[model samples]
Target chain A: MEFNLLAAFFATLTVATYFLTNIVYLRYRKTLLNPVLASTAILAIVLVMANVSYDTYMTGGSWVGTLLGPAVVALAIPLYKQRDLLFTNLIPVISGIVAGVTVGMASGVLFTQLFRFSEQLILTVLPKSLTTPVAMQVASNLGGIPSLAAVFVMVAGFTGYILGPSLLSWLHIDSAIGRGIGLGTSAHGMGTAKAFEYGQQEASMSSVAMTLSAVLGALLGPIAAWLLL
Target chain B: MKYIYTLLHILVIVGFYLMGEQLQDFFNIPLPGSIIGFLLLFTALMLKIYRLEWIESGAHFVLAFLPLYFIPATVGVIEYGKLFSGKGILLIPIVMASTFLAMASAGWVSQYAAKRKERSD
Candidate 1:
């Protein structure tokens, strides 16, 4: 098959699977089977079964990839919606995010060193806590492969979504604001999705934290890379 | 008229991005055009120059479709299949632990601060 045709086919197939997976997740609301994880897994399996190379998939995939920037800008809407809460908790929220992102970046570097991954991999792991679009840009700016950075972001999101509630409860940090910030700052979009289950306050705060973390992560990403690498 | 309003909102978003692109070039930094655009849009709303109602529909439209956009990039992870070998095997646990740490510390500090403020009040 021609490369363009294959790319188009896979792109359509991937989007369709994501739509279907989202329906299943909505019906089931299972954390283990979240749309992002489930859809990615199903598409990966399909590609492997079809013997399609990643390169071919990405050709048409890039069409979807191009929207990342605009979607990121759209995040400002939620941020704006929560403007009153932001103004009210301005100092504590900023401090919390500053602390969270700092710790998150530092620990990512610390783990990469402890694990003895390559220099290239170090850059990839540094911005793992941000949303995928912002994390990809941060990683690319810091000399990492953008796609690899997306994978790392997904890992962080998945772990946070799966374990966030348990971890929050174990720590006895019961504040809705804190729970939202914790999950959102650490896990990004997926974490915020889970936060919605907790309540409206948690969900909104998660959005706030997600936006703040993305901005702070972007600003701090280069500085962290320079200091660590 | 509503369609035109939405179109105008979309144009405003794209315009900010273009401005952000210029700022990115002028600053000679790694900050993304979209982020800078986000900042610009945020400032505008905060200043009351643009109302949320103007862009809410457009922004929500884009956001609702956000995950679909990431599908291609996630698929690209297959290219790094080699990372699963060697030290890469340890990545998942380490990443999970770090994510937990971030959540714990952030949650702890924020909760502490909020409690302190409440007590003072």
Candidate 2:
């Protein structure tokens, strides 16, 4: 009975907090205020202060996490919608994702090695640029902690969402496809959301790039793990 | 009635996910089942096996709450207190630099390709 009650309470808390932070994000339009980042921080702090264990919190939180698989499957809808544009720009789109995913994985391994992180930590960060669910899966397959992999994915997302625009502008990456692929490949879902601020084309391309990067990242993650670790 | 339709659509999407899982288990594939499900659904749509409207509303509903689904796992990071203390904080800069490099390289390559395509056209 207590488990059920706690489950309901934490589940409600998670949803309510997400909505509230989402409102704050919508109002401020700041990457730092991203709903995922804000809500994760809020919930983490609340749990820590209340002395709640991660296992206890997950009793309810897992219900929400279960939906992630379906949400990833749902990505097919947007990718389907953008099929025409994707094909028309196939050359740049494919090349950009290939380059970006390679560089994203390579750079992650390179930096983590330079910092002399543990092998497990290096594996965790290997799939950082992929979408959250895929990254977590890849991380686990590579013998890293899946939960920590999620955190690294978020860090990558936040980093790209915050710094991506200025970098794009400075680099004269003015084309919509270029901007979208750049952000999406580097940041995943958060980057796609940021890409929306540009225009429909950028948003569509970003979503496509985000999905494709997940596919490519999954295939490449193990290879990197083998080569680096 | 609308809610029923939405639920049914969601069921179909989830069904695809389960199918992907089964296939993965059977084949011992390296890819995640969710990704296999995504590809399966995308192919089904392309092949016109599933109409867009059938899954459109459900997909939208699910996608809207996508970020919410990630909270549980991300919050799990609190368990790794050691990773975030002291020198571990260096990860912030490391992540930032790599992300910048990725964005720059992708943008440059795609922009160059796009510009070249434009010139040829």
Candidate 3:
């Protein structure tokens, strides 16, 4: 009942559920029922029913979010190890990141406007397709709610995970690198997860794209907001 | 040998966070600590300030739970239910669908451009 205990409970619950769900995914190869998605849905449901606010949930959420720094920095080893591949494919990778991030941001703005959403909502929603912390900052700086940006990123990531592969198939693009970047550039981490399942090349490139897209999106999202919105 | 440097992960993360935060402020910007964190680690490895083991353990642990962080946000969407209350459930699907389409198109466009560049090379 106490807020501190309640927040702690949720935090523990978050970590526990995530670990368990991932284990389940490994055993069952996953489905529509990803642990992360399931856990998020579960917490959201509990918090609302209990009348706990976003601030309360964020007490725990922020802790997890803070760890993002270490995890992101860790990406360097994988990326650095892959430098030879990067060197060879540097042109394509850099080009893909630019085009992917630019188009993703532009279209997010364009589509939201088409829907008649206010310009503020447009800025908030435009950054949704990126990773959370970055998405939050992008939204915040552009005068959008960081909370809204967090929500959008989740929706976009899950949407990309659920539908990105099928969409790519529909487009008839088959290479692993293409598929990986396809998911990473458009969908962020969730998309990267799906890409990992595609194969070795898909996973590696997905990681590459995921990292590049996050950095590039962070850099570009605000600029796009200023110039376009 | 290369993997040995991977282990000092937490120190690497802390170092990056502090330095990255400063860099963002110095540049008069709002760089996400995570993005800068990665940049810091990447720079170190690229520059060989610390080897791979220098930060491997912390990095691995943090990445393992990366997906879970999004869970609360997705669930939080339920709060918006009343605001919708069938007023625009249809719009939800439309918005979601359009977002998906645009995201997919963006990815493909990037791929297309990348492939085109590859051919020219």
Highest TM-score against the true fold, candidate:
2
- Candidate by candidate, in order, the iRMS in Å equals 1.1, 0.9, 2.7
Sorted by DockQ (best first), the order is: 2, 1, 3
How well does chain A score by TM in each candidate? 0.96, 0.96, 0.89
Model 3 TM-score is 0.87
Best by DockQ: 2
Measured against the true structure, the TM-scores of the candidates, in listed sequence, are: 0.95, 0.97, 0.87
lDDT of 1 by residue, A1-229 (tens): 5977977876788778889998998899888777777888888888888888888788888877877887777788888888898888876677777888999999999999887888788888899999998899898888888988888889999888888999999999899879988988899998998899999988988889989999899999989988987
Instruction: List, for all models, the DockQ compared with the true complex.
Output: 0.73, 0.85, 0.49
Chain B alone, TM-score of each model? 0.89, 0.95, 0.66
Name the candidate, 2 or 3, with the larger lDDT value. Answer: 2
lDDT of 2 by residue, A51-148 (tens): 99999999999888888888899999999999999999999999999999999889998999998998888888888889999999999888988999
Clashing pairs in 1: none
lDDT of 1 at A16: 88
Q: Tens-digit lDDT track for model 1 on B12-74?
A: 676777787789889975788889888988988889998898888778777887888888888
User: Of the candidates numbered 1 and 2, which has the greater lDDT value?
Assistant: 2
lDDT of candidate 2 over B1-111, digit per residue (tens): 988888999999999999988998999989999999999999999999989999998898889888999999999988988878877788778877888888888878988
